[model samples]
Target: MRRKVMRTLAEARPDGLDPVPGGVRAPGRRRGSGWVAMVAVAVVVAAVVTVPRLWMDGRETTATAAGTLDVAAEAARRQVPLPEGNYWSVTTLISAEESAGRYRVTVTSKTERFLPRDPAGFQLLAMTGLHTRPLTAKDAAAWRAAGSPRLCGDDTDCENDVSPVGRHRYTAMPSLWPLDDSGLTLPLSRLVELPVEPAALRERLLALWPAYQERMKDWPPAPKGAALPTRDTWLWSLSLDLLATPVSGGTRAALYQMLEDLPGVRGLGRVTDAGGRPGAAIAMGGEQLVVSEETGQVLARQDAAASGRVVNAVLFQGAKWVGKLPRLPKGCPKVPVRDTDCVG
Candidate 1:
């Protein structure tokens, strides 16, 4: 079940001189009385100024602490659980910049669902490289040696050679993204042991929002009133698992530590979601995470600003998550076989 939380600020009133009573002249005051009144007024003014400053400082500290705790608690809530059955997820990426090009990528992940295979199933596996730059000659040669077809000429030619309709659609390929290795889990696990500092965390969150939106432009726009979640939305959710240390109260402390230690933290500001809930955005290094106010769940995550190069983003819903992969479907068949067999 999803829960929503909202933050609201209250207005403050300034206390100072009351209107002079009915414009009546004060009864003549003795000289001593005048000095006493002046002293009293000075004291009041000092209290007014100093008290507010102290109060403001206290409030700021409290806000920072509260925000940090809230983040950590939310992270604990979303930590990945040991699977009782097989799990699967798919992710998609659309460029946020118009000049980048018109292509999106999608990826799918799968794990075993039961015991005996638990070790392998418990292992996290991911597919990558589909949206990456075209393969190199060495990469192609390795694929060929592994039974993949040889390219007619170059990478482009090699891609054409593997065209599914005109050729065989093999069940597997050695050149596919590596899903068999242990990934960044260790580095991520280490991130959740630091401290909680919301101001710094907020800044990091805001930095990633633009990076995600910038890439959104590359995706075909969603239907009106529909906006896709940012890449950070997903990363934040995944990071929750790393934060789930038993000693850290399951995962909350782990998450707090991760947020505190996130390097090059930047904020992306408040993102307005179509669902009418305020969303927080952030980026850590190349990864991004967006958190929803309504669900308190991360909606998206991906490498949005990694050297302005190809990166993967994952989207999640409950236990389901998707990874973005790059694979173009075969173009329409040519009526007359010619040099230009494909059309854009």
Candidate 2:
């Protein structure tokens, strides 16, 4: 039955929507599949949202660069009210670049998800307006010099003699997607029970580590004497994973507070995300997050190279409650599969 479910998920997602950075996906699932389902479950958690604001203490606040906004304060003040609706709608823009011969190619795609408030209702997923182009001016020049050949690499959904530019697809999930990965398989109810205070939240998150390690014991052994990550590293990663989901504003504020207490996290002041949205940034090693200055909402999660160049990013455009789903993109038709809807 598990295998059958995995196959169904694979068949349902044909447009190849990538997941957010640092998310742990289950086996037989796409690399970013956990992020997708995690958000669906997030809406369920938000049903009874509204956590009390906690104090932001024991952390040194950093000053921003000139003309930068105070994103930390904005994040700490997050407690957005849950709007009345039957569906939770989220939109994200995914940007990624890959090395191809002499130059690199960048591809961008938009993903929209409408998770029903009712647990039994179907969740709609759509990927549209997939566009691929050269990563930089130098790469574009090189590509033009190379006879402007079609650069179809992995992650491109192009078939024989077809271009990968501007493809769209959609899927309708029959059940509420569970957050299944990283040794944890939590449902919406479980997520809603998490603590809102930074310390309490940290304790609750750390309590799950033992189970994660136990699950890892069954996998292939690490290299001889490979050093495991510190507990703080684990906490940082897991906290960011939760932040990537459609969690409540209070939960998001706690996550921001918790991340600040960890080592290596620094404020990047104001900057533009890959999607061209201006936001304040906080970075920890190669992973970084950008949040809206006005709403403190997470704008994007980026993975950068040692040189600080972003190789992949997932932009959180917006998420809110809606009464109905949007129509499918033109030039796409519906599929006749059970418990599914396709457009594009």
Candidate 3:
């Protein structure tokens, strides 16, 4: 299930690794925080897996879905055109997590390998997840006085004397986001297959929203008048996922179409990103997103502050699909399927 963002994005993810391990933690295992190292890795699947969607509530939502469809229809009707070329886009996904008056920055650069057998599934390869502790004069002085000496997780050069003393390092993790496409799954492939037509996409999204909502148990069900559980956040979450995942141009465009319905999301016109490239812009939930006018790919998302500091940012360095998995490391230990040894 997805977690809360920082009331901000980290409000979305504390360690920003909820899609993988439970929580980001200090190097070396904690006694009882349920910290895990590697998540489930992917192996080639030749046949198409037909799995039934599992609903945690177990109650049917066909009627409730009708309400969702109405929301989608409204969203679909208002979409503005934004086109993006089809190709695999490699990205450097970066986030600065705030805690205890310090920002723990995590940088992860990865290229995705789209599986033909599983159009919706992609293998994240050449992955690099690193953490940096940039300290201020006061913070450095405090750590130094505290004996700036503890070594960081494996890399000695990385001194453990950092401000936010509890951040973890996730490196070279090769795994699926939802872990797999099994029972009660997120319907990523199914959603991808839905025609780019906004109305059609909305239909499919509502069909899947119940299952998707089950996964987001961290948030309560939409009450009489709660904010995020509204149609906007529901569709916004799906649209955000598609933009971040390795999907098709049709899918990208369809989401932008639905996004047009979000009254909360305001287009800020053209803007340049931190990387100095021009793209269209929009804002929601105190976060602004700069999307490529051509590809519909999200360039960056940051706080709504005038300074516009980034909460999370992504730069699509490159993109394209490959026929086969990139490769495995030489003699990479083949742990048991359920083993927790693989370092992500």
Q: Of the candidates shown, which would achieve the greatest lDDT relative to the real structure?
A: 2
Q: What is the lDDT of residue 310 in candidate 1?
A: 22
User: What is the Cα-based TM-score of model 2?
Assistant: 0.67
Ranking by TM-score: 2, 3, 1
What's the distance in Å from true for residue 97, model 1? 6.3
lDDT of each: 0.31, 0.56, 0.40
Best by TM-score: 2
Model 1 C-alpha lDDT per residue in residues 1-344, reported as the tens digit of each score: 11001100111111222246435434432112222223222222221111001111111111121243355346545555433222232222221110101221121221110111122222222221122221445544444454443212111223422212133221121111121111222222233333334444445444545655666678897899655753443334334432222212334433444553444445554553222335665544444455564444555443443342323333443333123221323663311112212212
TM-score of each candidate?
Answer: 0.32, 0.67, 0.53
Ranked candidates, highest lDDT first: 2, 3, 1
Q: In each prediction, how many residue pairs overlap at the backbone (N, C-alpha, C within less than 3 A)?
A: 45, 0, 19
Cα lDDT tens digits for candidate 3, 70-164: 33334333445323322233444343322222222122222233322243433333333344342346655544554543323212233321111
Q: Model 3 Cα displacement at 320 (Å)?
A: 2.1
Q: Which tens-of-lDDT digit does each residue in 115-197 have in candidate 2?
A: 66665566676665456677899989987886776644223323411212365456665434433344334543345556777
Cα deviation at 309, candidate 3, in Å, is 2.6
**In model 2, where is the ten-residue run with the lowest total lDDT?**
47-56
